[model samples]
Target: MKRYGSIIGVKPEKLEEYKKLHVAVWPEVLAKIKECNIRNYSIYYKDGMLYSYYEYIGDNYEKDMQKMAADPTTQEWWKLTDPCQQPVENRAPGEWWAAMEEVFHMD
Candidate 1:
Protein backbone atom coordinates (compact mmCIF):
# COMPACT_ATOMS: atom_id res chain seq x y z
CA MET A 1 0.00 0.00 0.00
CA LYS A 2 1.10 3.57 -0.55
CA ARG A 3 0.34 6.37 1.86
CA TYR A 4 -1.00 9.69 0.67
CA GLY A 5 -1.51 12.98 2.47
CA SER A 6 -2.91 16.27 1.32
CA ILE A 7 -3.96 19.63 2.74
CA ILE A 8 -6.60 22.16 1.80
CA GLY A 9 -7.82 25.30 3.47
CA VAL A 10 -11.35 25.31 4.83
CA LYS A 11 -13.53 28.36 4.90
CA PRO A 12 -13.81 29.39 8.51
CA GLU A 13 -17.37 30.54 8.08
CA LYS A 14 -18.37 27.21 6.65
CA LEU A 15 -16.50 25.06 9.13
CA GLU A 16 -19.62 24.00 10.94
CA GLU A 17 -21.36 23.04 7.74
CA TYR A 18 -18.34 21.06 6.65
CA LYS A 19 -18.13 19.23 9.96
CA LYS A 20 -21.83 18.41 9.82
CA LEU A 21 -21.48 17.00 6.34
CA HIS A 22 -18.67 14.71 7.44
CA VAL A 23 -20.59 13.55 10.48
CA ALA A 24 -22.66 11.37 8.21
CA VAL A 25 -20.88 10.95 4.93
CA TRP A 26 -23.08 9.49 2.23
CA PRO A 27 -22.87 5.69 2.02
CA GLU A 28 -22.39 5.76 -1.73
CA VAL A 29 -19.43 8.09 -1.45
CA LEU A 30 -17.80 5.81 1.13
CA ALA A 31 -18.34 2.80 -1.08
CA LYS A 32 -16.84 4.56 -4.07
CA ILE A 33 -13.70 5.36 -2.10
CA LYS A 34 -13.26 1.72 -1.12
CA GLU A 35 -14.07 0.67 -4.63
CA CYS A 36 -11.16 2.76 -5.81
CA ASN A 37 -8.80 0.92 -3.44
CA ILE A 38 -8.46 3.62 -0.89
CA ARG A 39 -8.27 2.46 2.72
CA ASN A 40 -7.85 4.03 6.10
CA TYR A 41 -9.14 7.27 4.77
CA SER A 42 -9.51 10.09 7.25
CA ILE A 43 -9.87 13.84 7.20
CA TYR A 44 -8.87 16.06 10.07
CA TYR A 45 -9.44 19.71 10.73
CA LYS A 46 -7.10 22.13 12.40
CA ASP A 47 -6.72 25.88 12.24
CA GLY A 48 -8.80 26.24 9.11
CA MET A 49 -6.94 23.51 7.29
CA LEU A 50 -8.22 20.10 6.34
CA TYR A 51 -5.70 17.30 6.25
CA SER A 52 -6.50 14.06 4.47
CA TYR A 53 -4.65 10.80 4.81
CA TYR A 54 -5.28 7.52 3.11
CA GLU A 55 -3.62 4.34 1.96
CA TYR A 56 -3.85 3.37 -1.68
CA ILE A 57 -3.69 -0.33 -2.45
CA GLY A 58 -4.39 -0.07 -6.16
CA ASP A 59 -1.73 -0.98 -8.71
CA ASN A 60 -2.56 2.03 -10.85
CA TYR A 61 -2.95 5.13 -8.74
CA GLU A 62 -3.75 7.51 -11.54
CA LYS A 63 -6.26 5.19 -13.09
CA ASP A 64 -8.02 4.56 -9.79
CA MET A 65 -8.20 8.26 -9.13
CA GLN A 66 -9.62 8.84 -12.54
CA LYS A 67 -12.20 6.21 -11.88
CA MET A 68 -13.18 7.87 -8.67
CA ALA A 69 -13.38 11.25 -10.34
CA ALA A 70 -15.66 9.92 -13.01
CA ASP A 71 -18.21 8.49 -10.63
CA PRO A 72 -21.48 10.45 -10.71
CA THR A 73 -22.07 9.99 -6.99
CA THR A 74 -18.59 11.17 -6.17
CA GLN A 75 -19.05 14.13 -8.44
CA GLU A 76 -22.23 15.09 -6.58
CA TRP A 77 -20.47 14.74 -3.27
CA TRP A 78 -17.71 17.04 -4.43
CA LYS A 79 -20.24 19.62 -5.43
CA LEU A 80 -21.13 20.02 -1.77
CA THR A 81 -17.72 19.65 -0.13
CA ASP A 82 -15.68 21.53 -2.68
CA PRO A 83 -17.28 24.81 -1.82
CA CYS A 84 -16.16 24.57 1.77
CA GLN A 85 -12.54 24.01 0.75
CA GLN A 86 -10.03 26.33 -0.82
CA PRO A 87 -7.02 24.99 -2.63
CA VAL A 88 -3.81 25.76 -0.88
CA GLU A 89 -1.38 28.04 -2.57
CA ASN A 90 1.34 26.35 -4.63
CA ARG A 91 -0.66 23.17 -5.21
CA ALA A 92 0.25 21.37 -8.39
CA PRO A 93 -1.72 22.07 -11.51
CA GLY A 94 -5.22 20.60 -11.35
CA GLU A 95 -4.81 19.72 -7.67
CA TRP A 96 -7.67 20.70 -5.38
CA TRP A 97 -5.70 19.73 -2.29
CA ALA A 98 -1.99 20.30 -2.11
CA ALA A 99 -0.05 17.07 -1.91
CA MET A 100 2.16 16.65 1.12
CA GLU A 101 5.61 15.09 1.19
CA GLU A 102 6.32 12.36 3.67
CA VAL A 103 9.61 13.40 5.14
CA PHE A 104 9.81 10.50 7.58
CA HIS A 105 7.87 7.37 8.40
CA MET A 106 7.89 4.46 10.82
CA ASP A 107 6.32 1.05 10.38
Candidate 2:
Protein backbone atom coordinates (compact mmCIF):
# COMPACT_ATOMS: atom_id res chain seq x y z
CA MET A 1 0.00 0.00 0.00
CA LYS A 2 1.08 3.56 -0.71
CA ARG A 3 0.68 6.12 2.02
CA TYR A 4 -0.42 9.70 1.51
CA GLY A 5 -0.74 12.69 3.78
CA SER A 6 -2.06 16.22 3.30
CA ILE A 7 -2.70 19.35 5.32
CA ILE A 8 -5.43 21.93 5.35
CA GLY A 9 -6.57 24.59 7.78
CA VAL A 10 -9.89 24.84 9.58
CA LYS A 11 -11.21 28.06 10.93
CA PRO A 12 -11.55 27.86 14.68
CA GLU A 13 -15.13 29.09 14.58
CA LYS A 14 -16.21 26.36 12.19
CA LEU A 15 -14.35 23.53 13.90
CA GLU A 16 -17.36 22.13 15.65
CA GLU A 17 -19.39 21.86 12.46
CA TYR A 18 -16.48 20.27 10.67
CA LYS A 19 -16.07 17.67 13.39
CA LYS A 20 -19.78 16.91 13.30
CA LEU A 21 -19.76 16.34 9.56
CA HIS A 22 -16.83 13.98 9.80
CA VAL A 23 -18.43 12.08 12.66
CA ALA A 24 -21.05 10.79 10.24
CA VAL A 25 -19.55 10.95 6.78
CA TRP A 26 -21.88 10.28 3.87
CA PRO A 27 -22.10 6.58 2.98
CA GLU A 28 -21.93 7.04 -0.76
CA VAL A 29 -18.82 9.21 -0.50
CA LEU A 30 -17.20 6.66 1.77
CA ALA A 31 -18.07 3.92 -0.72
CA LYS A 32 -16.53 5.92 -3.52
CA ILE A 33 -13.30 6.35 -1.57
CA LYS A 34 -13.16 2.62 -0.85
CA GLU A 35 -13.91 1.89 -4.49
CA CYS A 36 -10.82 3.91 -5.34
CA ASN A 37 -8.71 1.61 -3.11
CA ILE A 38 -8.36 3.99 -0.22
CA ARG A 39 -8.08 2.33 3.18
CA ASN A 40 -7.12 3.12 6.76
CA TYR A 41 -8.18 6.69 6.21
CA SER A 42 -8.08 9.10 9.10
CA ILE A 43 -8.20 12.83 9.73
CA TYR A 44 -6.56 14.70 12.58
CA TYR A 45 -6.74 18.25 13.83
CA LYS A 46 -4.52 20.36 16.06
CA ASP A 47 -5.16 23.98 16.82
CA GLY A 48 -6.64 24.99 13.43
CA MET A 49 -4.67 22.61 11.26
CA LEU A 50 -6.25 19.54 9.74
CA TYR A 51 -4.21 16.61 8.55
CA SER A 52 -5.46 13.69 6.49
CA TYR A 53 -3.83 10.32 6.01
CA TYR A 54 -4.77 7.28 3.97
CA GLU A 55 -3.27 4.27 2.26
CA TYR A 56 -3.87 3.40 -1.36
CA ILE A 57 -3.71 -0.31 -2.08
CA GLY A 58 -4.43 -0.27 -5.82
CA ASP A 59 -1.87 -0.33 -8.58
CA ASN A 60 -3.18 2.56 -10.62
CA TYR A 61 -3.13 5.50 -8.25
CA GLU A 62 -3.87 8.18 -10.85
CA LYS A 63 -6.83 6.31 -12.29
CA ASP A 64 -8.26 5.62 -8.87
CA MET A 65 -8.00 9.29 -7.88
CA GLN A 66 -9.59 10.33 -11.16
CA LYS A 67 -12.44 7.94 -10.55
CA MET A 68 -13.03 9.42 -7.10
CA ALA A 69 -12.84 12.99 -8.40
CA ALA A 70 -15.33 12.23 -11.15
CA ASP A 71 -17.91 10.85 -8.77
CA PRO A 72 -20.93 13.08 -8.17
CA THR A 73 -21.19 11.98 -4.57
CA THR A 74 -17.66 13.13 -3.86
CA GLN A 75 -18.32 16.46 -5.50
CA GLU A 76 -21.35 16.98 -3.30
CA TRP A 77 -19.41 15.94 -0.26
CA TRP A 78 -16.71 18.44 -1.09
CA LYS A 79 -19.27 21.19 -1.33
CA LEU A 80 -20.00 20.75 2.34
CA THR A 81 -16.50 20.06 3.58
CA ASP A 82 -14.74 22.61 1.42
CA PRO A 83 -16.37 25.53 3.13
CA CYS A 84 -15.08 24.35 6.46
CA GLN A 85 -11.49 24.28 5.20
CA GLN A 86 -9.12 27.17 4.71
CA PRO A 87 -6.07 26.68 2.57
CA VAL A 88 -2.85 27.39 4.39
CA GLU A 89 -0.85 30.43 3.31
CA ASN A 90 2.04 28.35 2.03
CA ARG A 91 -0.09 25.95 -0.01
CA ALA A 92 0.60 25.82 -3.70
CA PRO A 93 -1.59 27.57 -6.16
CA GLY A 94 -4.92 25.82 -6.78
CA GLU A 95 -4.28 23.47 -3.86
CA TRP A 96 -6.81 23.29 -1.09
CA TRP A 97 -5.08 20.59 0.95
CA ALA A 98 -1.32 20.82 0.66
CA ALA A 99 0.40 17.51 0.10
CA MET A 100 2.82 16.66 2.91
CA GLU A 101 6.18 15.02 2.48
CA GLU A 102 6.68 11.74 4.33
CA VAL A 103 9.89 12.03 6.27
CA PHE A 104 10.12 8.71 8.09
CA HIS A 105 8.32 5.42 8.46
CA MET A 106 8.81 2.04 10.14
CA ASP A 107 7.07 -1.12 9.06
Best by lDDT: 1
Q: After superposition, how far is residue 3 of candidate 1 from its true place, in Å?
A: 0.2
Report the C-alpha lDDT of model 1 over 2-53, residue by residue, as the tens digit.
9999999999988999999999999999999999999999999999999999
Off by over 4 Å in 2: none
lDDT of 2: 0.93
In model 1, which residue pairs have backbone atoms overlapping below 3 Å? none
- By TM-score, the best candidate is 1
What value does the lDDT take at residue 42 in candidate 2?
A: 96
Kindly provide the TM-score of model 1 when superposed on the true structure, using C-alpha atoms: 0.97
lDDT of each model, Cα atoms only? 0.95, 0.93
For model 2, residues 4-104, the per-residue Cα lDDT tens digits are 99999998888999999999999999999999999999999998999999999999998998899899989999998889999988988877799999999
CA RMSD for every model? Answer: 0.6, 1.1
Report the lDDT of model 1 for residue 102.
Answer: 88
